[model samples]
Target chain A: MELLEYGFMQRALLASLMVGLVAPAVGVFLVQRRLSLLGDGLGHVALTGVGVGVLTSSAPVGTALVAAVLGAVLIELVRARGRTSGDVALAVLFYGGIAGGVVLLSLAPRGQATNLDAYLFGAITTTTAADVAVFAVISGVVLAVVWLLGRRLYAVSDDEEYARAVGLPVLPLNIVLAALVASTVVLSMRVVGLLLISALMILPSAVAQLVGRSFRSTLYLACGVGVVVSVAGTAGSYYTGTPSGGTIVLLAIALFLVVTAGVALRDATARRRHGRQVEVHAAHPHEHGEGCGHRPVPHGDHVDYDHDGHLHAPHRTGTGTHYDEHDGSAHPPAAVVPPVGRERP
Target chain B: MTDPAIRLAGATIGYGDVAIVRDADLTVRRGEAVAVLGSNGSGKTTLSRGLLGLATVLGGTVEVLGAPVGRLRERGRVGYVPQRHTVSGAMPATVREVVGVGRLPRLGLFGRPGARDRAAVAEAVEAVGLADRLADPVAALSGGQQRRVLVARALAAEPELLVMDEPTAGVDAASQAALADVLARVSAAGTTLLVVTHETGPLAGVLTRAVVVDSGRLTYDGPLAGAGTAGPDCHHPDEAARPPVRGYRLDQPRPAPDAVRLRHGSR
Candidate 1:
């Protein structure tokens, strides 16, 4: 409890909470649209922004926000200009951004060097007041946009063509979605690092989807799951002497697996019960020996050929039998027939 | 009528160097409902796009509402519902938001939607009988409902001409019927309609005229009944003055087996 009273711990907690709220909120749309890779690409671009800020002696988060917006705009432009698949485009942008960041870092003046490892894989313990404030502002703005346009976003995400035909400015809306994703990625980097940010963004939303019945429910549940994982992972790291960022991501993954397993188990149990009900109500007439007693013996005792060359047993009443022209019939033994009065038995 | 709503003289349409449709002379009267019918890849879409200024008119001239189609603004005067493929289903937007986009050209740069725009959107939604679904996510709606929303978006613009490309493709029978009924009502309300479609089932009685294109040429342009069984050139308006190509027929048999097979397969 004394450790929680410290300013750094509070700042880390606040930043993680903000990220946990914002990333999954944006990620619900991203995951539904199968644009999960876009989150990853934008996070990598945020790294380049960090490198640029470090080289120019500017604020890293501020620079990263601007860089992310620009990167998002470029991505939209590239997507509009080319016919390539979004994944392919994202791959190109990801590698290009990473290479650009490395070059920018190398070019920075020697005396103005900044730590790059912390940005690459986050150090939650090092979060400052400014970082917390920035996270709050970004998360608030993102939340506002999402709340205002949630229904529109849902429609577009489900069926872009239908949305456009109905008069939704699909192109502009897509750009906005991408922009939101980019902003969330940059802000989340403070808590989860550029490399592992998307896991925090996507995993919780995916887990929420397992238990959610609707789009709105999924988003709400995802935020809840995200907050829980972030707080638990942060505290566990503080007490257990583990890396906070990696621990949070692993925790989110574990939650996702558990949720998925629960859903699967419930579905399996329901299906088994349904199968039993269906079996009880179904009638079987061929179990009794009322008909098909005088048919010729089949070549195989378990199998017989029908007239159309299809196979069936002669003694099966409900199952029609057929005979092939190439096979000569042999008479069946009298012992195969049951006594006349024992039909039900 | 002051002037024909649309006129195309010797227009050639194609992508890059290959011409899919060429040397077409056509005119559409005000408030007319013209249905362009053709098999797959028969250049119906290209011709429709040309009228909307989406496709380049490689030669001759094209005009809309008495002005060159190139100069005609793309907003309220000429509303276009592109083929369903042009839009993505994975897009996130509500029916109202989708309808609201139809007002973009009218809104101008930096202009936001006002109460009037909202009213128009509402009216349009109501016109298509989708008022209850105005707040629904477009993906949750059935295919027929989605298509109705598209029509409502076009109606929001209150255009004099509404152009739809394959509006009923992949829709069920009821949806297709509902779409046709909506189109008929819109036409009755005085909007000229240019419908590009292969299946002419519901539009059979309502269409004012039918035009057929084949191999980059206008094969027939007349009343729907005058379209002969199968031919390369079959025109009406006179019997003796018909061109020699009018009687020239392809050897292909009527009611092609493949077409029959597909029809039965669909059922």
Candidate 2:
């Protein structure tokens, strides 16, 4: 209640909420495509934009958005040409942007022009009401785009080659994806800064993926993680006098580690229980190559290999399919239709 | 009669200026189960990609379902099963979720899947005999099962034309038979099937015709029985001692990498 009374604190919280919610939606797509580092690369490019805006006395957000979008298009073009691998092109762009940013910042006049440290690590509590409005607008656009293209994006990220074969406009979709990612990275600078923006984008999805069962569930859970971490980390930073962005990212990493450990423990226990069940059921444990010489033991649609030499009944698992381990034969024959009567026969 | 389900005449498929398969002419009538057989880098996959608009049609015309390959927009009418290895390694999607994606083109950019999409997904999973494992994560499935999931995803689209690349490449013998069974049902349903595989194996039972590609050229296009095994022109021609047809083993140790680099284009 006390923190909410202050105008700056209210603005910071809203900014945190906006970035926290949108980043993971974009992050899930990136993670599924195994391009998680693209966020980080784009963040570096945004740094150059910030530098240019600082030197020109223009709004940093607009400059950063433009630069990042241009950088993303360049990256996509390089990838399309196939001359160099994607990572190689991204690396070149990332380092070049950062280097250009550093050179520009060093050349600018020192006092009151721009606080480079603020853009690097963020100053969440310093966000003004105008910044909150911008965050809201940007977040609104990101969410709408994602909502409309979510399924198609999932298909592309799941398998680009297949999506293309299905005639899903892979290149344009990819470009749109890059543009959205660029927008999110630019908007998130207020919450987590350029350096730590990718933390917001990637960590929640990684954690949610470890525990969530399905894609939709993983996406919702990731948003939940992002929101929870942002609130707790922002409040903790206020109380502890720490940098808000760094604290939030650290909290995310901690949550990720905790979830990972919990998943590992749960898997271990399940493995132990499974082992016990196998031991109880084993009259004979057939090794990989040591075929049972008998029919497969069907256990409710699953073929269980028993340690006992007793031959298991050859019951149909589904649609009269049975497997004999000795010769690797499946019943009902592999073909669905009657065998084609070849003219030669 | 309706036009062929797919036709590519004098099509040169490649990435840029370099053509992989030169002047490949292929046609598949409705209700036919055809396999485009070739060794690795022999341009069989490229040919399929060309038909699906994945590859650049350097020359000649490529059409699908009475539409140009590049302009055809009815995605639900054509289903594709890419190599299984690319489908599962990255995402954490479940078998049901992945299969549900098959319904996306039908759903459009903003459309949602209602009862019809769900039913299609269920039917596909059942057809592949993976109904019990619908909720299982795709990563948890074995390589063979993963391949089946890909097939189910394509089937969920209810496509009239199904194109699959190496459906049984790394699958075990039993799973291969099961896949064959599923493909048979798809073919029996009157869907045109284009299966690209190196060895006929279990598919030999159902494939009505075989179109062989050697060095980016159509070597044979005839009934499955008449198409002889991989010969001197097939992959690894250096290993002439290797038996052709049923004896060709995909799991065999690789020859030199350069030996299979006949096509210098997108995979």
Candidate 3:
């Protein structure tokens, strides 16, 4: 209650909440495109922006937003032009940004290099009301663009060639995605810090990929996960006197590990408990195996015989020689996958 | 004659200035199933890409469904099933979700897919025998099923001209049969087909006409039966084709009569 009473803490919560919503909304596409580390790369460029702001006495978040977006466009250009050296090129550019930042900040008049700590590790608990307003405005823009182009973005990110063939504007959508990521990184700079900001963007999407069955569901779940961890991590930091960026990232990774273990556990349990259409054919005098005249089909680790209408796979588990009946399809139904936790009926 | 589904005349197609398929001329009337046969790197794929407006058309007119490929406004009018390798992503997508991309051609970027779109998607999935797995992730399906999903995605557009590149490549025999059955049904439904392949394996039956691409030109364009036996003075045609699954593994793609390969090799 005391923490919420402070104006600074209230601003921090609002800022982090916006960051939570905007980050994963954009991050899901990045995850789908397998460009999850673009967020981290842009963060390094944002650090240079902060250094520029320090030397020029300008607004750090605004400058960082501009700088990060420019960095993203350049990265996309390199990635588009040369697929072979794109990663290596982006890596060099990202470090150059940080190196440029360190040089600029140290040269700032009456500014210590130590001042970069707040930008690097986040100063969420000390954010001003003005900072929260910027976060809200940028978060609003990012979320609106995502709402308008969510399907189009997914179509391009999921398969660039197919989207291009079908005539979706792949290049413009890619640039918009890069811009959204840059805006998200800068907006959350005060909440999660530029150094760890990408974790906030990507981790929730990673967790959602493991949790949700489809892209739409994954995007929704990513937003939910993002908000919960961002707000909770901020609150946790306020109460425990810990850093918000570290706390939020750790919480997210913990949730990802937990969801992963939970999914694996559910699948294993469902497969064993479901029995996979096991039936007792002991009364039948016919034994289906090699040289039995019936067609044999390989089914995963075992072989199934095409007898009658069902694929009869033999199993020996203390019940004599039994057969598992499968539908005519070559592969068994995915009932063992255990649909999303909410969809389980 | 009903307007041809595709017409390319004196078209020079390639990336940048390379000109892989040069000065090509071809035409296909609506409802005809034509197979474009050639080995890999024979510019067969480039010819199809030119038709789709993917590769650069440096000179001459290239048209699809009676309109220029670039100016064709109706995305749903021409369904494209690209090579199977280009259709997948690392992300998890459901059969319904993947097939839903086909509707984007009609729906555009902002248009919501209505009930009619949903019906089209469902019909496409049913046509491919994947209705039961509509909600399952495509990644969970076998490679054959994944290829079938790509076909369904293309079919969801309900295009008048369906262009498929290597539809049967890399698939198992059973899946090839299943795919052949789907293609047969699609062909019977009156959609124009242009399938590019190195060999017409199980697809030999669905495609009645064959256009052989070699040395940067359509060396042979005739009935599927004749293209294979275009032999030293050709052979007789079989139309009384009962078992249509007989394959036609024609010439492998090699150096063109022109300098396309030489230019490529120098680079």
Best model number under lDDT: 3
> Model 3, A157: alpha-carbon shift in Å?
0.5
lDDT of 3 by residue, A115-177 (tens): 788888898977887888788889889989998888888888988767777777777889999
Chain A TM-scores in order: 0.80, 0.83, 0.83
Docking tier of model 2: it is: acceptable
Give lDDT: candidate 2, residue A144: 93
What tens digits encode model 1's per-residue C-alpha lDDT throughout B178-209? 67777888899888898887666667666778
Candidate 3 CAPRI assessment class: acceptable
- Candidate 2: segments with Cα more than 4 A from true spot: A83-86, A107-111, A277-345, B72-76, B229-238, B241-267
Better DockQ candidate (1, 3) = 3
Q: TM-score of chain A, model 1? A: 0.80
Error of 2 at B10 (Å): 2.3
Poorest 10 consecutive residues by lDDT, candidate 2 chain A: A336-345
Q: Candidate 3's C-alpha lDDT?
A: 0.79
Candidate 2: clashing pairs of residues: A283-A307, A283-A308, A284-A306, A284-A307, A284-A308, A285-A307
Regions of model 1 farther than 4 Å from truth: A1-3, A28-34, A84-92, A106-114, A140-177, A204-228, A258-345, B1-19, B23-25, B50-73, B76-160, B231-267
